[model samples]
Target: MRKHETYAQQPHIRIITGACPHDCPDTCAWQIAVDERTGRAVDIWGHPDHPITRGRLCGKVERYLDRVYHPERLTRPLKRVGPKGSGQFVPVSWDEAIADIAARLQQIIAEYGAEAVLPYSYAGTMGLLQGEGMASRFFNRMGASRLARTICATAGFEGLTYTLGAALATDTEAFAKARFILIWGSNTLTSNMHLWPFVQEARANGARVIVIDPARTRTARAADEWIAINPGTDGVLALAMMHVIIRDALYDADYVARATVGFDRLVARVRDWTPERAETITGVPAARIERLAHEYATTRPAAIRINYGLQRHAGGGMTVRTIACLPALVGAWRDEGGGLQLSTSGAFRFNRNVLERPDLLQGREPRTINMIRLGDALSLDPARLAQAHYRPRPVDPPVRPEEAGPPVKALIVYNSNPAAVAPHQQAVLEGLRREDLFTVVLEHFQTDTADYADYILPATTQAEHWDIVKPYGHYYLMLNRPAIAPLGESLPNSEIFRRLAQAMGYTEACFTQSDEEILREFVEAQTDPVFEGITWERLVRDGWARLNLPQPFVPFADGRFPTPSGKCELYSERMAEDGYDPLPTWTPPATRRNADAATVWQQGWLFCISPPAHSFLNTTFVNVERLRRREGEPSLWIHPDDAAARGIREGALVRVWNERGEVHLRAHLTEDIVHGTVLAPSIWWNKLSPDGRNINQVTPAEESDMGGGARFYDVLVRVEPLAVASEEPESTQQAVSLA
Candidate 1:
C-alpha cells in the first residue's frame, strides 16, 4: 500500500471541534479529522462529548466537508466588474480588497456620516465571539451604524423580561420530569430534530405531548393530540384557554393570591373569550380547546415549548404575552418540568457592558436605525426618511437622537444573507445598490446577497474554525477546536475581524484581546451563583458543562416571580406606562381585518411562507446540488379545494400575487396546509425565476405596533394559472402575476 494510504488507514486520527452556527435550535458540535502530511480533512462526525447534541450532527453540518471543499467556494477576494447583482466579478488580492473596503468606509464616514452605513446581520451564524459580539464591537468602535435588531426575538424578550425580570428558563434536561409538554407553533421534529430524542424520552416516561398549530406538521402528527387552529389566531386561543382555566378554578389560588398581581384585571379581560368565542377566531373546535385547556391545567407538571414562529404576525407580541401567562396561572413554575420553556441557552455568558467601555473607541458616534423598518428607511418616501431623521453624526455625537438612519456608509457582511432573508427583498436590494454605499460580503459561494456586493471575501466553514456554542433552546455549553486549516486563503470570522480591527488602527483593550482572552474574560464576567466554579479552560477540556442550580423546582415557587411587583405581572405596569394594554389580550392581526385582504386574496388567501429546513436558511444550503436536487424547484403549497377553485391542478404552473409583489411557482395541492392558508418555502429568486418567486416579495414589512416584531404572516394574496406560455414558459411550468 502507498505510504499516504497506509497513514490514512491508521486508527489514530486528529480531532477538530466546532459547532454549526445556523439559526437553529439544535446547535450541534462537530468533530473532524485531518491527514498529517497533506493537511486535508479526511473525516467528519458528531462530537460524542457534546451534552445537548450527544454525537448527532444534522444534514447541514454533516455536509460541511463538501461545502468547504466545493469547487465554487470563494478562494480569494473579488471586485465587482459589472453592475450590482449582475454576477460579474474580477479576482483581487487581499491587500487590494482591504484597501478598497477601508478607503470606501472612511470616505463614507467623512461624507454621509457613520449612520449612513448600516451593519445589518441576523442568526445566520450564532457564534457568540465571532458572530454578534465581535461584529458589533468592531462597528461600534468605528462609530459606524447601529442596526436596532427588533425584528425577530426582541418583542418576545421584552414581554418576557417585563414578566419574569430575567431571560432564563429551566434547563431542557428537566424535560424528563415533565408530566405534560405543550408544543406551540413549533415543529420540533423538523426544525429542532436534535431535541426530539429528549422529548421522546420524556414522552416514554409518561409525559403527554400536545401540539398547537394552524397546520398539521410532522411534530403534530407525532403528538398525542393536535389542535389545529386558524393562522394568526393563536392569541385568541390562548386567551380562551386562560378563560377556561380561570373560570373552572383550575389556577392555584394560593399562588394567584400571593405570586400574581394582575389576576383581577386579567380575569376581567379573559371572561369574554370563552371556548366558543375562541372557536370562531381559531378554527379549532370548542370542545377540543376546552379539553386541551383541561389537560394542561389538570396535569401537575406542564411545560410550554414556545417557538419563534408564533411571533411572526401583526399581533405577535400580544399572542406571545397571552401564551406566556398560562404557566404562571397554573402555578406550573412550582414543578421541576412545569414552566414556560422559551429558547434560552446558558452556553456562553454575555456582558453588554463590554460594548460600553470608553477605552474602545474614545468617542465615536453611531448612526442608529430600527432594523425591522429597513424598507422604509431605504425607501424614497421623504416623509419616512424625515421621520427616521437621516442626518450625519460622529460616532459618539453629543446629543443622542431617538432614531437615526443606518449610519454605515459601507458594510462588511459575514455569515448572513439579508437580501434573501430580510423582508421585502426588492427594498433590501435597492438599499445595497446605493452608489455611495460600499458593501463587502464574506461567503462560501456567490449568494443572492453576495451577487449585489462590490467586493466578495471568502469565509471558512465550521469544520475549519475553532468555536464554541450554546443552544438557544437548551442549557449546555460546548467548545469547538479547529480540525483543519482554512481551505486556500479562506480565514475564520475571528481572523477576519482581527485583521479589520488592526487595519482600522484599533489597539484598545477590546480589539487587542485575542479570541482565547475574550473567552476567558466572558467566563470570568459571569457572577451568577449557578456558574460559580466554571472556567473557560475547564469548559474547553470537558467539551461541555452544565450550570449548577439549587433545587430547580423552587425558582418560581412561593410567589417568587422576579418582577417589579415580586409577582407575575399579568397586568404589566410597564405596558400600561407605555400606553398599551397591561393584560394579555387578543387583537386580530391587522391583515385579516384589513380591507386589502379582500382585494389581495380575491381568488384564494395568501399563505404563510415558512421555509422548509431541507431547503432554506438565509439561502445557504438550498444552492447545494444534493439538497437542491432533492428539493427541486420551490413549490407553492395550497389546499386541494383552493387549487381546484382557481382551476389550478396539482403540479400546474401558477401565479401567487399580493399588493407587494408576485411570484410564480409549481402548485402542489395538499391538505398539509389549512384551507385558507398556502405554504411556500422562502428560496432564492434567481435560482427559481426572474419574476421574483422569493416569498418575501409578497410578505409585508409592517411591524406590530405593540412590540415591533415583523408582521410577516399578516399578508393577503391570490393564486391563478398563467394565461400564456411563450412569454412565460408553461413547459418550464412558470407562473407570473403582479399587483
Candidate 2:
C-alpha cells in the first residue's frame, strides 16, 4: 500500500450515517464512505447539517477510518499464554472462551458470593446502548458489587447538582448568543472543539472571550484575556468575584430576591473573600479580578463554559459550585444564552431504570465500590471489604460486607482501560496481577488493562454496532445504525453481556432484547416536551434534530429551578446536612502547601498534566500509527524559568518525579505554561516510550476532597536532565494525557 494509494477504491461511493462514540462531549454525526467493490470504508466525514459539528470533525476523529482498520485491532478471544503483564496470549474460539469465563464466574460467585465479581467500565464508547444499557442490566441481575462511576465529572457535577441540579443549565447552542463568554479550565479549541466556532462567532459579534486556566492553552492563546490562576484556587476566585459584585451593588437585585433563597446569606459569606484576598491566593492581580467581575456583571448575556479540568484537584467540587453560582448572581439566567453551561443531557427523557433494571437484583443491595479506588480495593483482603479498612466512597448509604458478600475476586473490564485511566495505577496493576483474580477484558486492542486479563474477549468497534447517542454537551438524540459487519468474532459490548446472562441461566426477559430493541424502549419512553415531535423516524432521517425548545431556551427565566425550593441553591441545606459548607469554599491542594517538597524555593513547582494535543483521546488513538507519528512522542512542557533553574536545555531529555513515580521525556521550554506550572498531554502506550513510562508514573492515588475523584493536578515535582538510574522501574509505568 503506497502512502497516497486509496485502499481498493470502488466505482460507486455510498454514504452511510453514523455517530462517533468515543468518550467526548461533541458526538459528531458523520457519514461513512463505503466502497461498493471492496466492501471497505474509505472515509468518514462530519455531516454538513449538524447544528453543533457543522461539517467539520475534531482532529482526533478526522482520520477515523485509520483506527477502524488498524492492524493491531483485537479480532478473537485470547487466553493468557505467558505470565501476567507479559502481553502474551493465544487465540481461542468463542465457545471455549465463553465457557471458561462462565465457569470461573460461577466458581467465584459460589465461593465468595456474587459481590466477588466487579464489573469495571467507563465511557470508552459514549454510545448510550453499548455504554451502560446492557452492562448495567447484566451486572444488576448477577447481584455483583455496585460500582461508583464518578471519575471525571463526579466532583464538578456533584457540586453543580448540589446547586443547580443535574443536566439543568444553559445549553451549548446558546454560546453564540452570549455577549461575554468565560471558558474556565477547558481547552475548547482542542477538546470541546465544536463549541469554539460558536465562541468565535460570538467574538465576531463583539463579545469577549476570557479563559481562566493555570496554563496558557491553545484556546487561551486565542482568547481576549487569559487569567493564569494557581490551581485549586478557582473557588476563591469565584468568591472574590461575588464579593465585588455585591460590594459594588452590581448584582441583579430583583432577580436574586425572586429567584434565589440564599441571597442575603451569600452576600454575607462573600464579604470576606475580597479581590485582594483572592489575588494572594489565585496569583491573579486584584485589579484584574475586579475588572473581570465588573465585566461579567455588566455584560448583558454573559455565558460561562465550565469544564471538569479544574475539579481534578482535591477541592474540585467546591470549585465548580462556586463558579456555577456566578451567572445566577448576575441574573444571567434571565437572558436566553446568559448562564453557566455545563451539560444538556436533561433535555430528553429516557427510561434509565429500563436500561439497568435494579429489579433484577432480587433484593440485593451489594457493597458500593468506587472505581477511582481500584488500587485500595485490590489490596484489601476479600474478607475485610465490608469491615474496617475498606471504606469505599459511599454513593448512598453503603451496604455492609456481611450483607453484600466478599471483596472482588473477578474483574470484568469493558468500554474502559482502568490500568491506565484508574487512579492509583500501581494499586490497580497489583490487583490486576493477583493470581487468584479472574480478569476478563473486552476491548478492541490489547490495552494495558487487557494485558492483565485471564481471558481477553474481542469487542466490536463503534462502526460495527448499534447504539443511541445522548450527549451531555449537546441536545440531539442520535440513533447509531451498524455501518459495517462485525469483523471476525468481535461482538458489541451489549452482545457480550447478553451471552454472559444466558450462560448464567438468567430467566429474565430483559436480557433477551437486542441492542435495537433496547434503543427502541428508550426512545418510546421519551416524554419530555422538548422532544414533542421527535419520533424515532425523524431522527433516523435527519441524522440529528435540536430539541423543540423555545427560540431562546431561557428555561429558568421564571425562577423555576430544579432545586427543592425551585430556586438556585446558593446556600444548600443538603450540603449542611452532609457536614459540608452550605456556601461553597476553597481548599488548596495539599501538595502545593509544602514549600520544600521538591525544592528549596518558597513554592514547589506544580506539574499539570493535560492532553491539549488534538491527536489523542485518553489512549484511544495511542495505538494508531499515523496519529502517533503526527503527535510525535510524549514530551514534557517546562516553563523557561524552571528549565533555566534546573540547567536543562530546550528539547533535551529530562526526568520529572516526586514520591509517587518518575518518567523521562523530551523537554519543551516555553511560556505557554505558567511560570510555576508544567504541562503534558497523552494516552501513549507504555511500549512507545524508551523507559516504558508515562505521566501517570508520578501521579499519586490521591482522591479529591468532596467527590472521591482522582486528584490529578494536586502534584508537585522537579524536572532535571535524564540520568539513568541503577534500579529498575515499575512494570505498570504507562502514559495518558486527556486535556
Candidate 3:
C-alpha cells in the first residue's frame, strides 16, 4: 500500500494507521488524520477494512484526542520537591533525570542488592513494544526483583488452562450463529463493545440471551432474561446446572464419553449439587436453575461469554473451571458459536522470549514479588514477606531474608496506576509515601501513582509512537505507526527504557536497536504457524493482519484438545497435585465465610463489588473532563431495601467501611442491585474523589485460589448515612441503574 495522502490527493492532510494501546480486548485498528503543516492530529477513526472493529470506535476512544491534547499532559521530567503524595514537582532536563536516576539505582543496588529494586506495571498499555519490550530487557539486565504481574485475569487464565489446555475460546465473530447465549459476569456493552454487535446479530436471529450476575448491568438489561445470583456463588450455580444436565439425561453422552475425562468421577461429585441445594447457596430459584440447565443442554449452538470479574474471589478459578466444563458435556464445540468464550489470547503466540530478552539475566534468579501484594512487597519487613512464586495460592508462613531476599528500596512504575487500582488502598498509599523508597514513574500525566514518584518522566501516547498490539478477544495483530510528532519533550516508553540502559553504562548492542528494528526481530522470532504470512513488512503495509486460522474456527470439534491427555480434562490431575479439588467444586468467598466479630460486628454488613465504571477503563480516562463529568462523583449503588434499612435515601452521602478502611460515596438506591449487596463502579483517583479514597479502601489484598490473582470482589462492608445533604436533586421518575 502507498501513502494514504497521495491516494486522497490531499497534500496538507496525511493519514496514518495505528492501534488503540489502552488495556482493552478489542484491539481496534485506527486511522489518524494529521495536518502536515502543524503536525497535529485533526481526526481519528477506526480502520474501515478491519473485520472486528468494523470502522467503529468505542465511546472512550472516539474522544481520545482530548487525552492526547489535554493541557495537563506531562511533557518533561520533573523532580518531586515536596512530601510524597503532595503532587509538588520542579522541571528537570532528560539528561539530568536519567543520570540522577541511574546513580540512585546503582547506590541502592550496591547497598541493598539488586533484588531490593522492584518494577511494577500492568496492562495500562497493551502495546507489545511500548509496554515491556525495552523495559523488560532493562530490568532483566539489572537483576531486579521480578514482578509476577498477576493483578488481573491470571486466575481465570489458569482455570482455562487446567480445563481446556490453554486460554482458548470460541471465535468472537461466530457468536452471531448461536441460538442461545449466556453472558455471565461480563458487561459486554461497556468493557467489550466490539463483540456486542455479534451478540446483537444473534439476538436478531431469535436467540435467547440470558445474563447471570448480581447486578443488572447494561448487558443484563439488554439480555432476554436476567437471573441475579449471589456474588462469588458462580461455582455453585455451575455445579447445580451440571447436576440438572446429568440427572435429567439432557447432556450429550456420546460427545462427553469421547471428548472428556473423569466423567464417572464428575457424576458422583455433582450428584449432591442439586438445584434445590444450590438455590440455598446461590440465592437463585431452583426452578430457574433447572430451566437454565435444560435450555442450555437442549439448545444446539449454545454460547457463553464469561469475563474475569467472576474470578476475582477465593473460588474464582474453580468457578471458571466448572463453567468451562459445561460446553464439553453439551457437545457445544461441535458447531460454530456453540462453545464458551473466556479468552482468545492463546491463539496469538508472539515471540516474547526474544522481545523481552530474559537472557540478559545471566543465570541470576531474583526474588519474585506478586503485583497484587505490592503494598506488602514494598512496606513489609524483608524476612516477613516470604518467598513469592507464581502459585495458585499465597505462600504460608514466613521465610528468612536469606530466602525471601531484601525489602524493595527502589521502585519503577509504568503503564499502571497502582495507588488507585491495587487493593488495600490505605496500605498502598502508605507504601508509596515512604521517604526511604526511591520511585520512578514514566507516564503521560501526573497520575495518582506518579505524584509519589522521585522522578516523573513523560511518556508518549499511542498517536506518537510505534508499537505492535495483540488482541486477547480477537485474532488480529495490529501495527501502530506514529501519526504525529511527540508532543513537547515526551518520548515513547521504549525509548525511555533504552536511554535508562545507556545511562547505567550497560554495554549491550540490543539496547541500541531502534523501535522498528526491535519490532522486526520480534516478528521474525515467531515460530507458530499462526504467523505463517503475518510478517512485520506486511503489517507495516496493511496496518493489521489476521492470524492464519481456519475461517469460522472450531478448535475442538474433533475431540482432540490441546491438553496433555489430548482431550478436555473434566478432572485435572495437575489440579489434584496442586492440592485443589480435581473435580469442579465451589469454594465460598474467604472474606464472607471467615467473617469474624471484629470485621462483621454490624448486622447490616453488605457484600460489596467494585467493577469498573462505563466511562473509565480502570484509572485511565478519569482525567478527561467529559468522561469524568459523565461518571459524576464516585457513588455507590444500593438496593432500596438495604438503603432504607439503614436510613440511607437516594443521593444521600454514605460511608462504606470495613476493617481495612472506609470510603465516602453518594448512595443511589435502586433495584438494579440485589438485596444485601452494594455495587460501586470505580477505580477513581484519590485526588479527584471527595474523601481522598475509592472502593479499593474496603477491598482486601487477598489472593484467590488460583494464579494468585487479586480478590477485588471478595469484600464485606457496612453502609450508613453520613448525615449530609444530597449533592444534587434526585428524580424518582428516572431509571436508577446504568441504563
Candidate 4:
C-alpha cells in the first residue's frame, strides 16, 4: 500500500485513492481528501481517469463524508439491555463483547452442532476483503450451514448464462456509438447514474432511446419514448417481439445458422406468441409492439440495457433468457455497440478459492438454506426440517433426510439489513424476536436489523478499511486503501471476524491474515489473462485498472459463446436438465392480473412494485437525514382514477394491505404509473416509517423460477384512505380496470 503523505502546496491535506465499497454497480474509483492533522476525511470525489466514472459521483455518494463522520455512527460495541426490537443498549468493551459472543456460539455448537450456526450477509459492501474474505473462511471452517445468498441478481444472471453462455455483454463505453438503445426495466438515471452519460452521448449522436417499464421513472420521462407495460409481463413482450422478428424475416439468417443452436425450435415456439396475444397480457398495443420489433431488427448497432428489476418475478429468469435471445437473433453481436448488457461481472475472473478458501469445508456437505427464505429458515421447527422446502439452488446437493440438521441457533449478520429489505417482513421480525436465537450484528449505524441483535458490533466505514472492488457494470479492478484511522473503537469487518475466530480457539493461520495480506494473496494468485497487467504496485499507484482486453471488447462477436454447444443456446438443454423449460416461455406472477377475475379477488386489487428511491440505495443511506429529507416520507404512487375510486385523496394517509401484512403510507396520486398498479419508492427503515413498517410487509416469501431469488415485485395490495385519526383504515368498494 502507498504511504500517506501531505501535499507540498497544502501541508495538512493529503489525497488518498480508494474505491467505493457500496453495493452499487458503479464501483467508482474515488479519491478522499483527508486532513492529516485532524485525521478526518475532508471530501471525496470520483477519479478523473476512471472511464465509466468520468470524474463524477452519484448524489448518494457525493455526501459520503457525512455518513462516515455522522454523529449517529456506532463507535463502540453494545450489548442489548432491553427487548430484542427495543433500541436499548449499553456500551461494552471489544474484549467483553467478543468473549461473550464466542462463549454463546460454543454453547450452541455443543448443544446442537456446527451446522446450527448460520452466517447471514449480502452486498452491504462489495469488497473482496471486507465483505466476505475472513467471514467466509470462519463459517466454512466451523462447518456451518451454507447460505445461498440469492436476494438479488442470481435469477437474471442465470437467465443470461443459459442464453449467452456467460454474463458478458457489450462494453459500456460502446453505448456512445449505438444507434438504438432500449433501457428496459431500468431507471438508469438513478440506479446507474454513471452509464447515463454514455446514453446521453448516444442520444447526441442521433440515437433513439426507449424505456420499457410499468412506471414513468425519471429515466423513462427523459427517454425518446416510454412503453408502459404491466409488471412481471416483460417475458410476454419479448416473445411478441420475437414473433414479429421471425414472421417478417427480420432475423439475421446467416448469423442464426452459424452462431446459434435450436433456432428452428425457437421459431416454432414463438409462433403462438403473437403481438395481439401479448397486447392483452402486457398492456402494450400490438401496433406499438410490431413497430418496436421492426425498428430493433432493422437498426444497426442496436443495444439493450436491462437491470435486475425485471427478474424479481415468477418468470424473471426466463424473462431475461427470452430477452437475451434478441441480440443473437438479429446479429447484434457483430457490432461493438449492438449486443445486450445485463452484467459485465463474468468478465472478472477473480480466484475466490484464494480469497474465500472454500477448501476449509474439507468436503463437509452442509445443508444450504436460501437467504430469501430467512423467515422460514429461522422459525422452522427442527422436527419438520426434513419435510420443509428450503429451496436450495439447483446446483446444491439436496439435504438427505438423515442430514436435515438442527435448527439455526446462531445468526451472525453483516453487510445486509434483512428486516427492511427482505420479503415477508412480518415473519422475519417474528423470527428476530425469538429469545433463544443468538444474533450478532456488525454495522456502522443502528439499522432495523441491528435493533434485533443480541450484540451490536461497531464496523469500520469504507474510509477506514482496505478492500479490492470489482464492478458488475464495468470491467475495472480498483483497490481501496484506508484513508483514516478507525473511528473511536470501531474495527474493520475482517478484524472483527478474525478476533471472533481467535476467541473460539481456532488455530488456523487463515484467520490471522490481514486485509492487505488476503487481497495481495488473491491478486498474486490470479492466472487469468484478464489480470495480465493488474498488479498490487500498479493498483497502489494508479488506484484502478481496466481488464486486459481489446479496446472495443465485443465478447460475442465471433459467436464462440462459452456454452456446451460453443454457440448461443436458443434452446438450452442445460435448462432442461435443471427442470426448467428448454425453450423461452412466459409464466404469470403469483399475483394474478385482472383477466383472472376470481384470482385477482383472492389476491389484492393493485399490483405493487417497490423500486429503490432516487436518494437511497436500498436501506444504506436511509439513515442519512439529508438524503432521507430529499426522499421525503415513504409514500405510495397511485393513478388518479384508482385513488378517486378508493376514496383516497392526494397526501392522504392510506393503509396498503394484503394477506401477508400491511403498511401505512401517504398516498400521492399521479398518472405516471400504469392503471391498477401502484409504485412505492423504497426501502425505508421500519423505525423511520409512520407505521413502523415498510413495503416489504406485504411481499411474500416466494422464489423466482430458477435461482431461488426473492420475488419482491411479484406483490399485490389494496389501498384505502385512513378513515379516522387512530382507527384502523377501512376499505371502500371500487372497480378499476387492470387492462
lDDT of 1 by residue, 404-463 (tens): 343445766777777776776666777778776678888888887788899988887766
* lDDT score at residue 40, model 3, on the 0-100 scale: 90
Tens-digit lDDT track of model 3 for 1-739: 4334443577788888899988778889898888888999988888878888888888889889999999999999999999999999999999999999999999999998999999999898999988888999999999998888888898889888889998778899999999999999999998999999999999899899999999999999988999998889999999999999999998898899999999999999999999999987778999999999999999979999999999999879989999999999999999998999988899887769889999999999987788888777777665435634334553343456667777789999999999999988888898999999999999989999999999999999999999999888988889999998899999999999999999998889989999999999899999899999988889999999889999979878888888888889998888887778888998778755654322332544678898889999999999999999999999999999888878998999998876678899999999999877899998799889998889989887768888888899988777888874233224211111100
Instruction: List lDDT for all candidates, in order.
Output: 0.70, 0.78, 0.87, 0.88
Which of candidates 1 and 4 reaches a greater lDDT? Answer: 4
Q: What clash count does candidate 3 reach?
A: 0
> Which model is ahead, 1 or 2, in terms of TM-score?
2
What lDDT does candidate 1 reach at residue 550? Answer: 61
Q: What TM-score, over all chains together, does every model reach?
A: 0.90, 0.93, 0.95, 0.96
List model 4 lDDT by residue over 1-739, tens digit each: 1223334357788898898888787889888988888998887888777898877899999989889989999999999999999989999999999999999999999999998898999999999878888899899888898888889888888899999888998889999989999999999999998888888999999999999999999999999999999899999999999999999999999999989999999999999999999998888999999999999999989999999999998778989999999999999999988899999999998789998889989999787878888887787665334433356345545555566778888999999999999898998898899999999999999999999999999999899999999899999898999999999999999999999999999888998888888888889999999999999889888888899989889998888899999999999999988888889889777665435534453434788999999999889899899999999999999999888877889999998877678899999999899987899999999999988999999887768887887788987677888774243334322222231
The local lDDT score (0 to 100) that residue 401 gets in candidate 3 is: 60
Candidate 4 regions exceeding 4 Å error are: 1-8, 383-403, 593-604, 724-739
CA deviation > 4 Å runs, candidate 3: 1-10, 387-390, 393-402, 595-602, 724-739
Better of 1 and 2 by lDDT: 2
Worst 10 residues of 1 by lDDT: 730-739
- What does candidate 2's lDDT look like per residue over 30-139, in tens digits? 87777767777778778777788787888779878777788888899999988888989999998888888999999999998998888888889888778888888888
User: What TM-score would candidate 4 get against the native?
Assistant: 0.96
